[model samples]
Target: MDISDKATEREEQDRDIALHQRKPEGPAATGQCLYCEDPLPPGKRWCCTACRDDWEFIQK
Candidate 1:
């Protein structure tokens, strides 16, 4: 209810936001695209089923 409480709450919220922002975006993957032949995780994980299957086929 007082200014100190409000400031503390704001500080906590800011810390939470910073923590989330610093967290890793998502899981990592190691693979390659077939058609484009680009890297995997960096390429949004193949884009589609076709791309994925194509990658598998190419691997063979």
Candidate 2:
């Protein structure tokens, strides 16, 4: 393809990557893990990284 077309394709790819990496909005923490309902400290959504990753996976 032409240089301009290639540039446009790259831009679209970058946009796609950014969108995929963006986190989806979730409910506010309520003193529990969003995934496992385990107790959590204030301002925390997940009990651990594994829980967070699983939660995000299920969200998709």
Candidate 3:
């Protein structure tokens, strides 16, 4: 790929990574797991390994 193409690809990949790391942000999501609805660290997406796997499964 050309320089511009490679740059675009990298940018897209970075955006995807950022999106993947983004957590549920709101008062409602506070202390709740995004995947299993369990209590979690205040700003976390998945509460545990199981919840992370479940979310990754659904995403895929």
Q: Name the top lDDT candidate.
A: 2
Better of 1 and 2 by TM-score: 2
Error of 3 at 36 (Å): 0.9
* Segments of candidate 1 deviating more than 4 angstroms: 24-60
What are the per-residue Cα lDDT tens digits for candidate 1 across 1-60? 499999999999999989955736433344655456577675355657787677667667
TM-scores for candidates 1 onward, in order: 0.38, 0.56, 0.43
Which one wins on TM-score? 2
Cα RMSD of all models vs. native, in order, equals 8.6, 6.8, 6.7
Model 2 Cα lDDT, one tens digit per residue, 1-60: 499999999999999999966668878878999999999999788999999999989999
Looking at model 3, which ten-residue stretch has the lowest summed lDDT?
A: 21-30
Every candidate's lDDT:
0.66, 0.91, 0.75
Q: What total of clashing residue pairs does each candidate reach?
A: 0, 0, 0
Better of 1 and 3 by TM-score: 3
Displacement of the residue 49 alpha carbon in candidate 1, Å: 19
